[model samples]
Target: MSTEQPMAMRQIVVSSAEDIRVERVPWPDAPGEHEVLVRSRLVGICGSDTHACAGKHPFIALPYRPGHEVVGVVGAVGPGVSDLAEGDRVVLEPNLVCGKCRQCRDGRYNICRELAVFGCQSVGAMADAFVIPRDRLHRVPDGVSDELAALVEPLATPVHAVRRAGVGPGSRVAVLGAGPIGLLCLVAARAAGAEVVVVTDVLKNKLERAQRLGADAALDAAAPDLVDQARRALGGGADEGADVVLDCVSGQSSMTQAIELVDKGGTVMVVGIAAGPTTIPLHLVQDREIAVIGSLMYVHDDVRRAIELLAGGAVAAEDLVTATFPLERAAEAFAASIAPDQLKVLVSVAGPG
Candidate 1:
């Protein structure tokens, strides 16, 4: 007769503002039907995670697990799962949706009426091992590295936003914010044939990073003549502005600047989650006929496109992921994520795949 100990995994949770705790929970049981057990390799700390950690995420309540951006290796596949097997690398889509919702039925499920994110609204992939439905996992291409795979979730948002704004050949684009999402937006827009891309941020280091990522121009958001500088970089007349302005910051000031820097009949894709009610220029929006669109999470097509872009080297992950921490130091990872100097902070779970 032999006695063995059950396996346990470390799960990170945010109980309150600036409070992150790691709890040891029993390893998940063998996945049920249509589910796959995944061992996390890399998990990213996104803006939403930072906001949630600070108790400012309007939609996400506190005491939630904190990992949505994930790259994992399949440990086991439940019955009825055929496409995936142990050792397969995958990226999590993270959006939990209700199939009966109007948006879901209409094929726009990213905005399901009762949409709940995996990490925000439920148990997330911050654990060393987790079981998830097969539908939520996308296989990573053979050539894609773990770093790039970890970035798919974040990149998908900008892909959806760019598609929503219809950025195409010769279009002039100005992205407000040099964060991960904004830099990814620049990459997506340029790949979609945007003639020129200008990025703005308050931090000099972020602006410099954006330039390195191929921004035609990087400007100081605090500059009094920011609008003028953007217009000049966009190669237009004094009165003209960019064809599309993506407000990745989505703060009151950035919202106002987005409207001010978009050409008449253009679109403003709000990619960032606002902390609270933000007032934009209604009269200007009405008079200029600018379409202010709010972009939420992405659909699977966006995820597929993000994979292709990352795999093809269109979206470089080298500079975007500035810092990485082990699972034991998730608290420090969250702190670094909110740091003004960092772009994307990752928590190494199972480490390299």
Candidate 2:
């Protein structure tokens, strides 16, 4: 018996700055060769969505749908896709890399010259069904739940960031901003065997969540003695600072803090995007011999590793999920994502079908 909804799918589109509304869109069917048709199960509301909602994101065009942290079941597979079939629970890797770039040829596809991405650059996962090349889909292990599966995308960001910074044994890592990405960074750094994981933020509720997630210390970044707190919480002498500093927030001050907090020869990973020009101390960077690197969206392999982490129990997706909404209430979901108290907000689409 056919039980699918006969009506077309509903999608939220941004018509103008700060204006979002629901509109009807076609329901996608099975994809062509080298593609996959996924019935999205959960679509995460992200900070990028908030920026797009405000017309702040650089890549969002008018009247485009923008939810991309998606997990779903494979409803159909294109020709030559022997790796996946109908009824497989999976997570989609939003990056669509052109495999011919220098980075792609050299096995660094994350930095591919011509990368196609969902939500920000192309059609997003906020609809009932969407199609993409089979190269982006990752199969989850049997035990991983769909709720947790949706988080692989966000989780992959930190995993890639931490990997870029080489966070591992005996490393003292400080994560700026205790948002979901920061918290996820802490988790990844710890899993990489970092000796210290210190997360800082101005909000107590968020700091509390960080503590609950196994942070060694959660300091208030607004504290008058924040540097002292960070230095102490990081262990060793007052000036023996972090080996790696991760700035998960996109502000000029936070960028400065990221550079200042790391010790000589240490690496700084900027995972967040700032809205405007941010000053950097050129002389300090030169004298300190520090490496400042900006990390972009994760590669497909990182997404796969994120799924592996979920399956292996290295990080718990449930911990990051602060709230959820049905797909019909996507507006409310987006609103809650920007609220001061929420961590990760998700919209349920289709599950176990």
Candidate 3:
């Protein structure tokens, strides 16, 4: 066995109900069997982390490290691990799927019955070190910025959503919300060759950022004529409304609005999580035959392709990076992610480890 390192570091912690703490944690051990120990470098905060902290997330189990969208370096590999070794710079793909599930057998492992996301279901990268299955990692290319590498996980999500929405050249799309995920959805939709992509948000600052990020039009959701403006921007009536609508805001209002404004037969992709059930107008669905697709986390190929997009400069991952905090100051970082006017916040556990 290799000798263990000392000087254990702080682990950003979440106990329950908006409580955020940091505690000294031991360096992770070498992998066991098919696992590898990653010295985590950059772990970005997701909306789910905030919700999880507030006890609003349904999937969370407390006293957990809460960052799943992670990037790191391979420090040790366990027995049976091959093709990768120590010192490899990598980013993690967090989905752990049950190979025997129906969805897995059909190759749609994204929907596996026993699917488990890294931060949500296991020890996460918010800590200084963590062990994960070796296969969960993907190598980050040489030119890709650490900021971009950190976003590959979330980027893949919106990419997967847009793909399922069937967006491509000339598609008219609307992305609801201007938060991190919504903004990423806009970038992905635009990259998909959409002729026009509009983004909506209640905050003007976020809307302005969305405009700067290449949204063809940014609308204020609180406007009295919000729907009218969106429809008019798409060219004038319901028939001219967006060919696809991505609902990045999980509230009922935004959800219903996405369904209401798309053209007949258009697709509506929900990229956000709903706190509770909200009824969609069955009449609108029956009339338009709109395809409502609920996108979960990204699949394997989605993560790979997202990395390709980042490495090739197609996706503006770094633009999405707003703040970086040392792992010791992780509580402050998580609090900042909840504040307005920020995009992506990252906790740095290990420096390019």
Candidate 4:
């Protein structure tokens, strides 16, 4: 017999708040029925993962392995799996929903009663090997690099949010916060044939990036005449406003700005996660007939569309990968993720071995 040993799986486990360590763990065995074993290639660190690492997330407890935005290659498949085989590159749809729930039955699995995110709810994809249900894996099309594939999950969020707002051809959209999600929204909106795509942010660099990403107008959030500038950009004067306003920040101030910038009957899509509860102008929403919609994490369809968008060159996902770290430097990756200048931080996991 040849003298060769199998590679051990290295897992980046978060034992407690602000404590992340990479340890060599036993390699996972064969997948169960309807499950697939994935060799993680790249895992993006999300804001929620940071919050969980800091022990600030209400739902995520300590000792969590925080990794939801994951890209990997299939290594093994269970007997029940048919669509995917070994060597196929895929992106993990992190949301795990109970099929028997009412929300799942109604096709809104994002809000299933027993919904749990991959990294936040259970084990995350920060390991060299991950075994998950086959249905949660979406194939990455050809020509999409590993770095771009890592961003499919983040891009999927904005795709779902923009679609929820009914953004289509000729629609005017104003995105509050030129963060990753906001920038991706600009891409999605432009792909959807939006007439005017305006973005607002406090950071000039982010706004500049937004402009580079095809934003029609980039306005400073602290400017004295931001409202006037937004109105002029949308060609809505003072009375009319953008057809859709996306609150990618989701903080109190961003929500207020979203409500004020949208037209009377326009839709305000909330895509960001707020730290705590904040008061809203309920009277303004009711009187103006404004539809304030909340968009959670994406579904499987959004993941597929995001992959297609990245593959088709609709959005340059590589532009958001500002920093990268190896699996051994996962702590540094988490630290860099909170930096304002950093758009997306990815942890390089195991290769396609």
Best by TM-score: 1
93: Cα error in model 4, Å: 0.5
lDDT of 3 by residue, 1-353 (tens): 23466667656779874567777777666679999888888899999988887778878877777778888878888999887878788999888887897899987888899988888877677877788888788988998877789989888999999988899999989999999899889878877888888899999889998888888789999887887789877664655788999998878899788877888888888889888888898888988798888999877888887888788776666578889988777778888898887889998875422
Q: For this target, which candidate reaches the highest lDDT against the unseen true structure?
A: 1
TM-score of each: 0.96, 0.95, 0.94, 0.95
| Model 2 global lDDT (CA atoms, 0 to 1) | 0.82
Quality of model 3 by C-alpha lDDT: 0.83
Model 1 Cα lDDT, one tens digit per residue, 1-353: 11122477789989875689889888788899999988898999999988888888998898899789999999888999999988999999999899898899998999999899999999999988788899999999999999989999999999999999999999999999999999999999998999999999999999999999899999999999999999999998898999999999999999989999999999999999998899988999999999999999899999999999999998667879999999989999988887898999999985321
Q: Would you list the C-alpha lDDT of every candidate in the order shown?
A: 0.91, 0.82, 0.83, 0.86
Candidate 4: tens digits of C-alpha lDDT, residues 34-142:
9998888899988788778887777788888777888888888898899998889999998998899889998899999998999998988898878999989889888
Mind sharing the TM-score for model 1?
A: 0.96
**Cα lDDT, model 3, residue 15:** 87
The candidate, 2 or 4, that scores higher on lDDT is 4
| Clash count list over all predictions | 0, 0, 0, 0
Q: Evaluate residue 150 in candidate 3 and report its C-alpha lDDT on the 0 to 100 scale.
A: 93
C-alpha lDDT (0 to 100) for residue 124 of candidate 3: 76
Query: What clash count does candidate 1 reach?
Result: 0
lDDT of 2 by residue, 137-250 (tens): 888789998878877888899999998889989999999998888988888898889999999999999999899888899999888777678888899578777899999886
